[model samples]
Target: MLSYARQTLKRVPSFQELLQGTMGSAKEEISVDVLVIGAGPTGLGAAKRLNQIDGPSWLIVDSNETPGGLASTDVTPEGFLYDVGGHVIFSHYKYFDDCIDEALPNEDDWYTHQRISYVRCKELWVPYPFQNNISMLPKEDQSRCVDSMIDAFVEARISATKPKDFDEWIVRNMGVGVADLFMRPYNYKVWAVPTTKWEQMQCAWLGERVAAPDVKKVITNVIHNKTAGGWGPNATFRFPARDGTGGIWIAVAKTLPKSNTRFGEHGAVTKIDADAHRATLKDGTVVKYQKMVNTMAVDSLVQHMGDKELVDLSKGLFYSSTHVIGVGIRGERPERIGDKCWLYFPEDNCPFYRATIFSNYSPYNQPQKDVKLPTQQLANGSKPSSSEAKEGPYWSIMVEVSESSMKPVDGKSLLADCIQGLVNTDMIKPTDEIVSTYHRRFDHGYPTPTLEREGVLKQLLPALQAKDIWSRGRFGSWRYEVGNQDHSFMLGVEAADNIVNGAVELTLNYPDFVNGRQNTERRLVEGAQVFAKSKKSVD
Candidate 1:
């Protein structure tokens, strides 16, 4: 089945060379000014920039047939779509916004949603940004948090230096109650690492990203029993109108010159001769370039280059895998769900750390309103009658599970367990009919911001840049502060600017500095044609 799908897709005009190279005997060698590895958002961003510049000949390649990397999406047999976890399109740069806007142009091309987020505690819904909303907590718990905040405020007055680790930073800012209740465990569930193992230097990303409590306001709210709303930069976000997040990238790729982009079999880069400035594809075609922009994970890139020193240096970095699970049900949207965007889970009641009301993103994410299907089972393990196929509308929920050596998961029954968890958490009703499900595991889901991460990246990145190779991206540079889709895309854009114009690569080096402001300097300019050839290409 996979082979037939590959063959059928290869017949597309844009994939002619890819098909010939994969199935035919004619292998070719070509050279360009630049070679890009990985067709994820970062790689696409670089390729798009290179195409705009028209300065250096370039070609972008990836192991996967489609783009998006960890930000991609998948569909179930019953026509339900789910992104890798809950992908929200919140941009910190105009370029990022423009690129997406250019791909999905119509008003109906996207779904704009206001963020409705919360933290699930002992049967209570704590408004997100837990530090600022202590009124939801029990009276005793509120007292503990307030006392610690006062103590931290006092300590800050006397201390001349900054906190040493994430734990200390939390204690110094949020106090003990909030930390013990939500900050510590919630972070662990998300990062898959202990708070102490994280460096304080990374706190800069959370500067304004996480809301700091206004002590006076909190006290007033607690006394008044007022609840806080979602507060922070990403209080609202956008999602693609179709094809999930991957649809956005695929559309972006379509806007680029066909000759410069490769996917599927031809996209796979099997061997890299760094000294020879050459890369070999699975079909035995060799491509040489003057400079290479690699967006693949640093470790994978090192292995492809066959460099011992680089591989050993990459070992200092650590990462956790992610499993995205989706559940599609046949019923009216639950009244309890309302318009919630995503919810955080800190306890062990469910293996997943977060769940998004995926159906809320777009009505088309599930089967059509008129499609007919049967119920597989109920949320409470009850069998539903095999009745006539009938449907009006459908909705879904996507859950994300982080896995590492410290936090292992049972892959065998993970889907079943997650479904049961949904029922336990009141996410779905006991007799709700289950219609579709989706699950995908990505090995490099997140780049851990461990205490040792900075030291290693300090040495590894420069060493590669010295070799005229710029390694930048989410996992490429290994900094979570700059690992989001926006940051990752800009990392590539900035890398290209640095290589072509000697512009300062701010996003690659100083994540805090770039993240602290609106970053207006990175906007797109009209008539900035970097490529000389016609944008049109022959199949």
Candidate 2:
């Protein structure tokens, strides 16, 4: 055993040798024109743009060994794939669409799934765009909702002032009945903010997030007992066929020159010296940069820089944590759950605000029907009849539970509580076999679009720029309105453009314009055209 141990030990460098190697690298000054601090969609976006320009020396680093950050996927030992949350490929920018297509060009690389979403309330599945499908609701609820919406329509004719907050916006467009029944409760669950705190959020972010019901159409639907169909950008979306959502990012990362990426512990940023224009990595390597595009949380970035005022200023930005739970069951895809993309849990039967039929998104998301796996336990927490391995057909569900100061989550029993909640909501049979389970909590999940968010960003972003640091991303910018995967990616791309030339960041400065309209300014097909024309010469 000692001889064998010596043989294994011989392959590894001595601590002294490792220390010296680290010291040697630390002493070497790695300089770049642009330094990207994260390799998520945002950082990758920045990196992609820089690579396309081919004029700047750039390095993109991420703490994780993988390329995707919050948008990454995880695989369970029992052969189940789950994403960070319910993420669908719904693009506002043609640039984003083109970039992803360039990475995974094959049509076979993705599975197109129609978004069949619904709200579970009072033991009934109400079709999504809840206000439009009031016919699906109980008669009492339908009557109340229609009556309140009629009152709101009448009230709006005389009221000239804008809504003071999101709560008021809901009351204005959706009416008090819908607000009380669905909007308010679901918002509280998903945002993890209390109804009272809804006033802290603004309505400007409400561009297309909510589908304002046409009162007449809704009334007609209720009268005719008909329902509504899908709405918004994600009405029909795409998911990668293999390796889950993370595969798309991994493919995109491969497009960039590998020499430019620094991932894993070696890439972890330990400290940032804004004055010196250098960043220290966890491996002790120091990077000197002309300008930095930071994709980390702004509050955390301030703490890393040890800037007291900036840290305090960043406090005004609100965000919620997300607990993602995945359940892999040893059974066939049930008829009842067929073709459902994701389901909402507005009622108290489930702890999760939203549950995605993950396996429905793609066949590759779960193990093949032939793969054998032993049951972990039953959904009811009862012992299985046998511990023997079983085969044929499996399915999975990915649920998201939000947590914030206003709403605390019990992390210890989260998985168990979630499974029970699933049973309560009839998502699974009490006797169903659970093969595998996964639970991970992301500290910075949804960036809250608070009333103070825009106010804080107005000051914080420009201040960081004064020091040659463009802090942008979901958390970096702290604008939930423009914090989707596409928006975040474009944020980085725009930031890179702003750094390279004096280009105006349309996505960053004018989110409403970008979100309201299709941004086709930068296209992959036009790359050759874009290449011939210098960005510096454009202005």
Candidate 3:
């Protein structure tokens, strides 16, 4: 029944067929009122706000098939799960809480736990906020710390000017004893940059991050041989019960309209014509928009935009790289590691700055009890006695190693070095069975608040805003003070509001003001009435 003319006619291609590259031309064109790039907290926040308002046509795109940027989680082929690093839920805004609660709404959706943390020094576990628990140190060490504290207290009384750098700040506050013993080495490991390089960094973010020791209280505690309890807002935290932190973002993305979002390779932004307000995607699709909310790193954004001026302006910004390693061991949770949430390593015994008992956060963090996996090797570097696959209880530890041009790490031997470090630090027995291991590196990790940071951001932000492009995220703003999951989310929310209704970006402009207290005004369903129509105070 086939005719020659009928057989020659091509069928109309389906959307799925077009996406799969099965038929039709590869190029397309689209236009929207707002374009959001990178579906992390920042981009998602912008999209959420844009959806709330009915006026503008908007679309959000990300190169990644999934959301959650640096806040993402990953799983090993063996089923062991690990987050990019330590990510805990402690929010300043009700909108953030609302979004998370909306994503993970059921009572069984999360687990609430008290924070139990410690610092490893002198082969003894000392309560955190090490200066406040000098009592736990050896008697000679304790006396040395107290003497230095007294000297620092006296010096602080006579000093009139603010501490010039982080080193001086530490000495004036904690004295030489605590500074040399803990603050200096611990911070160096965490930042992968020396404290003496404080001129290239800032200490303003130290308020809640660092606990200032009270002279009288510290002395009294030392006299009584007491340990300090948990400190700061993260004293208690929550974790998603099923998938890791990535689950939160994925769930939140589900609440948004599918038509307004594009992910995967077709969504990758290849080139941005800031002048023409057009963005070319990898698949040769072009998107023209009135405004852009960019969540990608500022440096990356500049390179993509191909603006040499912006690229040169962003050179002053400095950052460190992060290496996240996870080790899955087949056994019951060790007695010494009982219920510890996270532990800080100041000594050289471990290459990692911190190790989190990731499995303790949720039973689902590792493979089910029934799944079987054979040991790759003994922690001591010995061959496994048995090659047969093994079943049963399992536990895992996640470690973070910081690196930069200042502090280099050997990528090839990193996993082996980390395992040996676990043994050297007494975190695992020499013969412990290691079932699975995971390693990932993020080039743009911690954004260092260099001495020149303020000057650079002042110029860069305004110049980009001139083109109707709002670069506003962790690296986008280059302000670590408001770079947590909660703050990053609000940055996008505020950016969208600014585009739509000329609202003030309180979180971006006034980090200290927003961080100092609870930000309850901005809710998902109910917009912030006060800041919604207020003009931005900062240019």
lDDT of 2 by residue, 1-539 (tens): 00112222211122244457643434456767788999889999999998898467788989999998888999999889999988888887678998999999999999887889988888888999898999998899999999999998878767989888999989988899999989999999999999877888888888777888899999999999999766887787889999888888888899988768888887899999998999998877788887999999999998889888898898898889999999999877899898888998877777899999999988889999889899989999998899999895999999999999899999999999999999999899999999999999999999888888888998898899988999999888888878888888988998998888766677787666666632233343343244336445875
lDDT of 3 at 384: 97
- What root-mean-square deviation over C-alphas does model 2 reach? 7.8
The alpha-carbon deviation from the true structure for residue 373 of candidate 2, after best TM-score superposition, in angstroms, is: 0.5
Error of 1 at 332 (Å): 0.9
After superposition, candidate 1 runs with Cα above 4 Å error: 1-26, 195-204, 518-539
What Cα-based lDDT does every candidate model obtain? 0.78, 0.85, 0.85
For candidate 3, write residues 221-248 as lDDT tens digits. 9999888777776788889998898888
- TM for every model, in the order presented, reads 0.90, 0.92, 0.92
User: Where is the poorest 10-residue window by lDDT in model 3?
Assistant: 1-10
lDDT of 2 at 449: 83
- Model 2 TM-score is 0.92
Q: What TM-score does prediction 3 earn?
A: 0.92
